[model samples]
Target: MFAKTLSASHQHGKRLSEPRIRQLGSLVTWLCLSFCSERLEICDFWNPFRNFVNLEHLELFADWGRPRKLVPFSAPEYGLTQLRTLKLRGYLPMEFVQWLLNEPAHVEELQLCVLDFPGIHCGGHGEPEQFFEAIPPHMRDQVVMDAIEDRRRLRGLARFADYQDKAIAPRSLACLSFDTIRRFKKLNKLYLYKPAAGRDHDDLEVYFSVSSEFRILLEWRDLILATRNTLEYIIFDQRPVCDLRESDDQAEIVCEVSHGDSYKRFVDIVLPTLIQGETFPALRMIRLFGFEPYEDDPCKEGPQEFELLGESENVPALLQAAFPEAKITNHIGRPIFIHKKWGELYGGGDVLNDTAGLLTIGEMIMY
Candidate 1:
């Protein structure tokens, strides 16, 4: 086949059918696959995809109706070494996720579909540690850190005049629920496609529950530690699911807390984790897209303004770590956290361009 790009969309119960089968050379470099089903029998032309050894992009979506699925139980790995960007949508199993995290993939940029993990935390259900341990061995020992002794400890130990690989341990991770960050050592950019495809951000709390939601966030917070050296940018991109009303609380925690409410809890945990100064030194920018956590419902007309999660003793360092330029802004493209003594922590009006682009919804182009 002389094809250069392949895009396939399969509705429920449909086999991933092709119009006419043809042999393609290494010239085919892009493959976009979307799917939906509950039946477990999702078959596609795996051999043809394999022959396209030059395939550099794979955008996959397996939209199973439920959080859990019983898809083709043992889908063998398709070896495609040249793949550079991997984007996943729809429901996924833990096994398939582990396969994506395989080290040899060497994906420079990744867009992860936010999905619920195996959250079985209750009496007789099993302990959280056991729940995590039950995952495959390759995805083990990834407890993220609160704070580390030093950056030297984060990198592997030394042997002789060079470095030592006693083991390439993910020792300094921020100990969040998600451990997949351990494999993306060389990743330059990571975009979290959020709770569900397009406009289902609220389903995160619904499907995963509030406590598990926080755990997911904790992992997201710790992700900085693993990629502090290589990771450059992060975007929390979410779209609205409804215009009726926002959640009663953006997130309400039943567990114990230093801060009383949900927003405060977030401020207490997430803010501190990223602002530690000693971590994510290589991070140039962290971007927040979509609505403010406490904003009023429905899309607005005359510009948007976000409330500032203002001052604490740590605010200065937070500014230093993330704002080092004028990247921080409110929804209306206004500066919320302005720096005076901390130097120019943001890019001034140029940050407004990003806000404009992101607000365009479906039109926002991905590079």
Candidate 2:
């Protein structure tokens, strides 16, 4: 189940109570709450989970993929011993951690990514340690990588060298993505996304800064060393920083990062780096999440939209030679942008039932 809240007032269990929760107890297996906050209290707090007897997966987040809070869990009330997978982000209550580890749950594997530095730039409590200290020893290795930044990005490469000394010793492949060859010995999947900018990134300035051309190359090199021995898939989420309008037919302009060296860099530098390394023995596929920009002329009489073209032809060869034993997928992102007949915009989903030929450009805004 997915639940999002504008504020912390949504009583997730209000609709489900005591005996009623038991109705779907056998059927309910997963529960996920991604929100900005979590306020724990008596009464209806655990009401929804009372009869979640078979719940095997539970993911609780704070501040929208931030971290989960460490609120005490007084009782399971009816003995919820079936939990198997627990993923916690943000702050977590120490008392509950012990309960999850001690009782029938004995959750062995944990998934978590935390950022608790005053300089983290994220809106919540920036001090990361406060959240981690609340976690018990049984859950330490479960901590995934959380990127380290010194105000600006790229130029901040020097910081990764000292990461081993930091508490919680972040070692997840995804968290330390920005700094390559940082030492996630068992890392398999790596992602390098040009964060889509807009309201969702209001604090972007404080998080990262522009990197020099050489610095970008260095970033690629870091990726090479890090993935040399372990990577299996490389997913690149390419989105331009320029605030461009959502695609709305001919009038709406497509803000494609593929228009620049981003794609070329991946082809010319990043890909080549994969083969040059001694590792990457497990490397298989490289996926690029972007598409080339094209023009539309509906008034001139033609197809409704652009062709469903994927990555350029030559990329497959480059990836294949690097990992002659693994399969390669040049999965390209679709250029279809959501534009409502009314003047509204959206990110995902096929472009339909709306103005499909207009295009515009402005700051990238997302709800």
Candidate 3:
């Protein structure tokens, strides 16, 4: 049978039209809803989909209207007994995380892209023990929770600190980002995006200094020491900027970028003593994006190779020398050098320069 997609919207006081709920109620497979309305209670519209017995995928998008107590009975109920994926977007409460961890054992992937929450700040120093505690022990190992664009919300949790002190296993997780993996003691595979710009330089340094965010890099390093390790891949979608120095008494702002070769000076001067050897050992595959082209002669040459920031043949070579068995792939706009594991994938044509380019990376990824 073909999969079904359903969307619903309501104005202030009107109930969801009967036809809308009926269309979703009859679906036996996948269900997706992008709903926004000030008048309709989200629970009222969601109640019908809970009856589906054959749902394999379910997605919901909603906004914060009122605080609904997390109840055991009101969760989405797919009928097929084969639901494996759930994706939710909006200002999800901590209770939503609890519901996902409480979901049936068959669900394998749970993605939460929270655009806004009451108190969370992106890349902040807030403990998420209460949030993590909601995850049941058995379900913890089987679930992969992805939190995109999450900010830390660290205001009034002193009373909850005692519950957050316990440790949990990390192997159950597959892909996690932001602060989710920072507090996680054991993570198997991690995907890191570039940090957003416009953060205070001093605040950035202080946070990274204390948080476990850099520890993931260290853990990957340690995997190289032990032959038996869990980490298989470390994918950096964008380069991370570590040093942001503002000119004193001058209007100049200087930011230092860190990656493979370009970051050697920063690493030697600052990171060696701060970060240990095992920070990035277990990495077998490194995928880099958003690169600048390399110029052969600084005085006269145009551009030769498209070199990814912090990721060059030299850096990959260093990693290979240390690991000896890992495969390093550098993806640039076009092909450059030949390595045992290097291959180039062409990006969309120069239509990007045109006022109206037909292709974009976001569109491509969605397509």
Candidate 4:
């Protein structure tokens, strides 16, 4: 039955007059057009589809597989009333992002690849700020801005600091990822890459000063207070600072101190506070990476067994004891232990290794 409809549509296109063609174009489910050169006069072909009231998906390609100037295609007439997804491949203008945000009621998912601006140099001319301001307030939370290897273009994003202080500032955003931390009000999830260590203090100070709505993930924890209480997941990626010199290395060896002491301070002081009942009432998961075990000190230990310092095998057990009803799964290359309640709730696992063990327990809870 579906095949016949397609066949009829193809036949109709062949026999239809130009006026009829315009009518049929308005009902197209999908449209793909290519221009040989940026100057190609192809406005008529686009006009019909621009009025399409039911376009669910759209893809527009230009330059005929070569680098050429492209023109902006207006979508207001396309009746994006029912459009669910929109994808643009090359040279998307700033106006495109604005258009998607304006039609918040119809678009559920939007992917924009600003292929022309590989370095994302739009910030130099104030385009980045202008682009962000054009985003509809209601849709800011759902937008994801992705750039590739373009740090210099984003350096000036701190300019938004002034706008953030306004009374009618935008606050519906639930997720945001940018090259810098300037102004964020209701962010819940964030992903940042390769941040400069020198800028760490300022970045953290900005976030910590604001109230966290839910979760935050970043490379450093310098500003996280033991009392913030709202964070659920914390991940740290420790890479040595670029400015360290031979003299700095020599001092560290003389003092017999590891350079990672600052990170340890955060874990020791902040981590324990989260597991306590008074903080993070909904805390469920805790993950620590690149962790080194505590070295034996004359004052600290007996026969070397897996202890809490470097080998955190016992950390999960301590947390389970504190939150008796919580599910605790220690991720240390294997499934260490599961409390009886969690075991029954998630499905019992062998003390050693059980692949499907946790799933069974989760299913029981749902039923």
The residue ranges of model 2 lying beyond 4 angstroms of the native Cα positions read 1-32, 37-183, 196-209, 212-224, 241-256, 264-269, 291-314, 334-367
Q: Which pairs of residues collide in model 4?
A: 50-77, 50-78, 293-310, 294-310, 345-361, 346-361, 346-362, 347-361
Predicted model with the maximum TM-score? 1
Best by lDDT: 1
Query: Model 4, stretches more than 4 Å misplaced?
Result: 1-21, 31-49, 59-79, 117-120, 127-367
lDDT of 4 by residue, 147-188 (tens): 221122245443365323211100111122232122222212
Candidate 2 local lDDT, 132-191, one digit each (tens):
453334432332122224222224343564432221111111222332245334545444
**TM-score, structure 1 vs. true:** 0.51
Question: Mind giving the per-residue lDDT tens digits that candidate 1 earns over 1-367?
Answer: 1111331323234323353322343667787865444333333322234355566777665532222323233334554567677765434454554544543337666665434322222112223674344323432332221111112323422332322311111010112234456655666666653321111123221111223334444565556566667766665543222112233322211111111222333454456666655555456555554324223322222443332332223333454545575244223111111122111112222321223234321222232
Which scores better on TM-score, 1 or 4?
1
> Can you rank all candidates by TM-score, best first?
1, 2, 3, 4
The C-alpha stretches of model 3 lying farther than 4 A from their native spots are: 1-12, 16-23, 26-28, 32-53, 59-81, 86-90, 104-367
- TM-score of every candidate relative to the true structure: 0.51, 0.38, 0.37, 0.29
| lDDT for residue 306 in candidate 2, whole number 0-100 | 38
